[model samples]
Target: MFDLDLWREIFQSINKNKTRAALSGFTVAFAIMLFTILFGIANGLENTFEKFFLTTADNALTIRSGTTSKPYKGLQIGRLITYANKDLDYLKKEFGDKIQYITPKLSRTYQLKYKKRKGEYTITGVSPDHQYLEKAVIIKGRFINERDVKNKDKVIAIGRLVEKDLFVKESALGKYIDLEGVVYKVVGVFSDNGGDEQERTIYTGYTTIQRLYLATDEIGSITIGYNPNMSADQALVLVQEITAKLKSRYDVAPNDQRAVRIGNRILQEKKRLDNMTTGLGILIPIIGFGTLIAGILGISNIMIFIVKERTKEIGIRKALGASPRSIVSIILLESILITAFAGYVGLLIGVGVLEAIGSSIERYWITNPSVKPSIVYTATIVLVIAGAIAGFLPAKKASKIKPIVALRNG
Candidate 1:
């Protein structure tokens, strides 16, 4: 039920003691504001983790060859180690059960020409499975298939940006683009969430690039998608196994870290993300509880002080036939009204701050810092309820005080 008289009295009291009202409101507002900013930053950190590490398939690993740093057998240090087609075949034959999809990549840069429009773009020769390893989404036509690799076809899959740059408003599918001197037909157009640079690359068959450029079986690197079902421990063991075998095959020293490098290591990265996420899970609640506790204490203390100041007023009301329940309701309602309004104001300010600073915080790995309004709304309700409860103690105590005693004290 709406109590117009009671609300009128509350507003009158608040107007009379503007300083007290402002101080109480500031306490609740600051707590909620801090709470909002803390959670928003935590969420932003999570978003950063996802965007940074999820660019490639979680189960993928990349193998790159480098010059040896240690001598083994008769080979001297600084010997350049390289991978060939036979290495891919060797892995398939030896660890076929552990491997899901595997592909070799040969990367180069070439000037692409369509009519008079020309732009330099990265060209990567990859097997069909490279599409999955790179997590490329085919927006049009199809990705490179085994037939293209086997037949060394000159068909290419261009990135979304590449298509936009060379073909303009027209679709690039089925159109022939001249790469330097060799012309290749565009069979597919794809997009990548890895951003513009990734979407600017062009993909073709590994064999085609090998035949035209290197004229050898040499590959730039090998990308493998391990079985997703493999546990982290199993993945680690598989990495060790692959590393040992590859080093042995190349006759590099066992500890020759420079000769063979394994990148991606998503399992390890994921474990770190998991740990950090768990820490955040623990952190958010602590922040909420801390803010709530501070707000409760602040509201409770102010309510006590307000009741002290209003002792003579309360006694006069009681002498004039005011009920004990009315005395408590006035204080409790005042606290709740102030708390609810301040919390909402704090939420809006926090959201505004997040929006204003979102662009500038990318360097800190915080992206899209924000809190759901509903969550803050729910928190505000909780704070109001808590404020009511906190004010109840002092209100109840004042209601029980004898009118003569309160009047004397005031």
Candidate 2:
């Protein structure tokens, strides 16, 4: 297998025609490098979307009440669709297993005050699962628990902006705060990606809000978490069913689509992701293989020229009884070595370029933008297979070179 003579001949051929050899190698290398970078760009976009979507629960949906837009069953068209504690209970009991976590939202206006600092924020009433819907990170203390909701605890989880504005330099943990002249202890200081306004928001227990402030069953909206494994179609179905149930209970006309507003963000987002994936599926191959096929064609053409140039010499070898298989192997070995070496060079350049800008890309574009080892290995395998295909026709054509044909061509 250690064919020194074959390698020596290969090198001799390259040395004889340096320009042609460089062109051949450069074609392969450029193709690999360009293709690799394009692949990285595709994957980086994918990573960027994944990071953004992960900020919110993949299966989370928010529902808001709306007024009837059409008259039905003796009801006026302007009937307001309202959701309350009992509505949540009814939905929970009706769609028990289908619903993962359902939380009612009742926005309360409070003059947020701690010591001398005071700010006004719409304190939202939420359950423990509200954290999942909002994806808040608790930096100081724990999020709301079931006990806090059930026992009507006078506690709150304020966002980072709230912490900074009200508490200033001091920590807000275990600190008593006033909301609308009522004292409540801060249990957690959280942060979200939703900018300064979102950070200014705070969470209070649903029961506490209803009992202490509103003194009535009044809810502005509801958030429902679907099972993580639910597909876009399934989520759409659930939303339709829930919307129908709510419309029926509230006596909104069946045809009044505006009475019950549903937001299937998970399904919408999933569909968008699927569309993006499909577009990339069509794009990547068209671009990557387009470059690769150019390289392959160049390799094939170069090999054909090499075979043609060596016609007289090959004829002499055939005269000496050299086997056709030897001729085919010789041409194939040279093609493989050229393509493999070019690919390796391209691999180094591609990796170096990515390493240089990886951090900058991740900071702004994607969370982590890097090619996987499997992708590199797959490229290598492609190089080998492409090398074989590039050399195949030339090798076969050269192999069929009868002494007369070679002599005549010469």
Candidate 3:
């Protein structure tokens, strides 16, 4: 299998036509390079989309009340619509198992102080279920439980950044922090993947906020987690039913969009995922055909030309008692070597480019751009196969040429 003289002749042939080999290799390398970069960018975009969606729970939905924009049933336009504790009870009584975790949110800005280090951060009043809705991971202590909510306890769950900001190097757990004028014990410290803004806020019992701030049973918004097993269409229908029923209950106009707005994270995520799938479905074939296949064709065409250029050499070898199979093997081996090496070089260059620019492209919403090795390797194999076919056609013809005819042509 190790034929030294055969390889020596092959290398000698390549050395004699360095320019042709270089040009052929360049075509393949360019195609593979372009192919790799495009796929890498696509993968990066996918990563960004996933990261963006993961900031909130996929099954969570938020319903916020706003001012009525239209007159209905003698109620004037611009009437402020608001949620309350009674609304939460009505939903549970009506929907029951359709709703998983429901929590009323009351948000406010309060001056938080811990030993003179004061900062105005968003203080949101939420129930224990809020932890799952906002994807909060409790790093210390625990979130608000039923006992805390029922008792209207003045305990707070601070975010990681909140603890870091006020507590300095010390832990905020079990420490009392002054909120405006009232001192609330920091019962827990939590982290969120939703970034700094989310991590800067603090959470406490909604009942505590309702009693302390409003002295009433009013809420700003309601967050609901639907049953995960519900289909996307079913979830959407549930949201519509809830919205329509709420508007009717509040005597708001049916067409008024501003009075009640619901945001379904799962719906948004599904649409985005579907669009991404469709886009990739269209894009992959386009890239595969436009770049990789083009490269394979280029390699095939160049191999054909290379065989033609060596027509007289093939003839001379045949005349010197060389077998037809030997002539074909030499040409085929040269084609494979050039295709494989050039394709690999292109792969390396493409990966290097992605690595170099990956961080810089994050602003462009492309994160960790890189191609799968299997894709590049598959493309290379395709190119090598094409090269073999190209060499075979011309090499087959050259092997049949008469010595006289080859000599005359040369």
Which tens-of-lDDT digit does each residue in 255-317 have in candidate 3?
999999998766767766757757886887697668877887788788878887777787688
lDDT order of candidates, top first:
1, 3, 2
Model 1 Cα lDDT, one tens digit per residue, 16-107: 99999999899888888888888898889889887866679878888998999987898899988899999999999989889999999999
Clashes, model 1: 0
Q: Give every collision pair in model 3.
A: none
The lDDT, on a scale of 0 to 1, for candidate 1 is: 0.89
Can you list the residue pairs that collide in candidate 2? Answer: none
Estimated TM-score for each candidate: 0.79, 0.78, 0.79
Q: What does the lDDT read for residue 192 in candidate 1?
A: 93
- Can you tell me which runs of candidate 2 are displaced by over 4 Å? 1-13, 44-48, 51-55, 69-71, 265-273, 286-294, 307-337, 344-377, 388-410
Local accuracy of candidate 2 as per-residue lDDT tens digits, 1-410: 79888788778877887886787788778877877777777788788777767666777788898988988888778878787888888988988877888888888677877888897987988999889788888999988889999998999999998888888899999999988778999999999876777788889888889899778777878888887677677888898898888888888877787889988766687878867877987998799888777766777777778777777767877888988877777777777777788887887787777777777877656445566656755665576677777667766777678888787887
C-alpha RMSD between model 1 and the true structure: 4.1
